[model samples]
Target: MKKVAFVVAAAMTCVATGAQAVDPHVAVGSAQYSIGISGFVPVICRATVDATVVPTQPGQVSLGSLNEFCNNPNGYEVYADYSPNLGKASLLVDGQKVPLGNAGSTRISKSNRAGIVARSVTLDLPQDVQSGSISFRVVTL
Candidate 1:
């Protein structure tokens, strides 16, 4: 019958090329995964000062002496910013004002994490600290 219809049309073209090589477009899908994270406490902190300028004679003027550091594990305080002719200066370490000054900062060392907590400050010159010119600075509040 015409060579059996050319062998049934070449066996239906080899079964349609083996059904397109079996891939058949089956991409069964499902996908989902996630991750996200985030940080800051960085106001670290630092301060240092050391003084001993000698040229004394009015009441033995001596407004000099300090050494400080604050790494801030959440603890720090030591301030003395003066230049108003030092008419109102009072900051001690082993005499008074351990934590008793507001506008001039007098809370010297209390909280510490040991990163940079070194202190040795003394400058109580208030007898009208005079000598012609003056300046001071040691802060980390």
Candidate 2:
């Protein structure tokens, strides 16, 4: 009987210690709380052009690839502009002639959905405008 009593006391002591060891972060009858997290990525578009290459035709200047990137779900457009703004320069992409705007910028291509695209671009400059460069612009729609 004495041994059984000692064992019960020891078991009660262990249970009491274990109960005290549990520390709660929240109050006993209080409402629970939670931490919320969020993030954002802004809509963006970008265009990159590689180095100029020798033209296969005598009067045309061939340029390297024009790569485009856009994240807008609607669409994107690629434009081309030349240096010196020399009178109505002609822009060709993959051998197809792209119409020029009066403001000196022309839309070379467009996409209905967000994606990455690449195309070959070329320029036909006037004889008066020698030694010039071409630039590209990307717009998210």
Q: Which structure among the candidates has the greatest lDDT? A: 2
TM-score of 2: 0.60
* After superposition, candidate 2 runs with Cα above 4 Å error: 1-39, 52-58
lDDT by residue for model 1 (73-105), tens: 555555544444444545555445432233433
Clashing pairs in 1: none
Taken over the whole model, the C-alpha lDDT of each candidate is: 0.47, 0.70
Question: Candidate 2 lDDT, tens digit per residue, 1-141?
Answer: 999999997896665555445533322223333333456889889988786544334356767788889999999998777554533567678888875545666688899999988888766665555454567888888
**Candidate 1 total steric clashes:** 0
Each model's TM-score? 0.24, 0.60
Error at 108, model 1, angstroms: 3.7
